[model samples]
Target: MTQRFMRATGRLRIIFGPAHSSSLDHEMTEENQRLLKQRQAEAQQWETIRRPDGSTYVVPKNPEDKSLR
Candidate 1:
């Protein structure tokens, strides 16, 4: 069997720079890292449940859709 890996891919942009400016690193700052971790954590909370009817459904991490507490 072959093993597969999931990767996160994205493009880089300079939010406040000129058109000729260089691109920024994806996870360049502490705040960016924090946000990435937060998003990944939230995504992991989701689940894919399979039913006896041979159907699969995705369930949200917070089924109640509550605010981030």
Candidate 2:
């Protein structure tokens, strides 16, 4: 029996079958890494506000002048 290995999302995965594990894993890993990095960058760019009541909310970059109810 032969065991195939694949890499996805910066992680290694093992597959057993006729599937091309190496190519598939490389592609998956690249795409997953790209998406993860993108998300991380976006998260860092956003500003979050935490309320004293243990609630958290995202602060809008632009706020309209409105009276608070």
Candidate 3:
């Protein structure tokens, strides 16, 4: 068969099958999911504080120096 004839099948790929996305979340482990949630929780507690000197810094909004709220 000619190259043009064989190349025709490549055009039908979209109708033939879906592409596999390796990035799908089905691969995430339970510990990875748990860590993601924990990081989100930690991110929420931060509050931006602008000082009169225009200096900027970050500290835990509720740093008990003991527990994670």
lDDT of 1 by residue, 5-41 (tens): 1111112224333234344545468987899899987
List, residue by residue over 1-69, the lDDT tens digit for candidate 2.
234222332233333434443433445568888998878765655578899999999864435522221
Tens digits of per-residue lDDT, candidate 3, 1-69, equal 444554666666567874343534467889999999999887878777889999987777777643566
Clashing residue pairs, candidate 3?
Answer: none
Off by over 4 Å in 1: 1-20, 24-27, 49-57, 61-69
- Per-residue error at 10 for model 2, in Å? 31
For each candidate, how many residue pairs have backbone atoms clashing (under 3 Å)? 0, 1, 0
Question: Which regions in candidate 3 have their CA more than 4 angstroms from the true location?
Answer: 1-27, 52-55
| Residue 47 lDDT, candidate 1, scale 0-100 | 85
TM-score of 1: 0.41
Best-to-worst ranking by lDDT: 3, 1, 2
- lDDT score at residue 42, model 3, on the 0-100 scale: 78
If scored against the real structure, what TM-score would every candidate get?
0.41, 0.41, 0.41
